[model samples]
Target: MSLYMLPLAIGPWQIALIVIIVLLLFGGKKIPELMRGLGSGIKEFKDASKEEEIEKNDKKE
Candidate 1:
């Protein structure tokens, strides 16, 4: 049962193919915009995490 239920693993080739598909679908011009949005999302997530940590420290003090 355990062997039959093992997860399928993703390899580097599969990741490359996915990236190629995304580039083709979005076109060359839109890739930068997509990356920029992704960057901002990561920045916002980090900011929120820092704010939560500050609030926790405040409560302890």
Candidate 2:
């Protein structure tokens, strides 16, 4: 029951409002481009992490 420790739980109405705001701010066309860039960035991060783990295991062996 700690206000500072726990993140606020978003309800469905809050989510819909947030989505509306994002649409207003970024517009319809830019959202897909932003999502694509975000997806690629995440993919690159995952690939880098896997490579690092493989390298660490090789060094240990």
Candidate 3:
């Protein structure tokens, strides 16, 4: 029996290539808008989780 292992290393060139690809696909202007949307979504999710925790603690008392 043989087991295969995938490489798990990322170097600077690999990162640069990925950035180039993303820029090409999304364009320079749309990238900032996409990032802003993603950041807001993450913030909203965290806020919702915090509210749920607060409600749970109140119910316990």
Instruction: Give the count of colliding residue pairs in each prediction.
Output: 0, 0, 0
Candidate 3 lDDT over 1-61, as tens digits, reads 2234335566789999999999999999999999999999999999999999999999999
Better by lDDT, candidate 2 or 1: 2
Residue 60 miss distance in model 3 (angstroms): 1.2
Query: Largest lDDT belongs to which candidate?
Result: 2
How accurate locally, in lDDT, is each candidate? Answer: 0.92, 0.95, 0.92
What is the TM-score (0 to 1) of candidate 3?
Answer: 0.80
Ranking by TM-score: 2, 3, 1
| lDDT score, candidate 1, position 61 | 100
The true-versus-predicted C-alpha distance at residue 13 of model 1, in Å, is 1.6
* Candidate 3 runs further than 4 Å off: 1-8
State the displacement of the C-alpha of residue 7, model 2, in Å, after optimal TM-score superposition: 3.6
Model 1 clashing-pair count: 0
| lDDT per residue (tens digit) for residues 1-61 in model 1 | 3666645666788889989999889999999999999999999999999999999999999
Worst 10 residues of 2 by lDDT: 1-10
Better of 1 and 2 by TM-score: 2
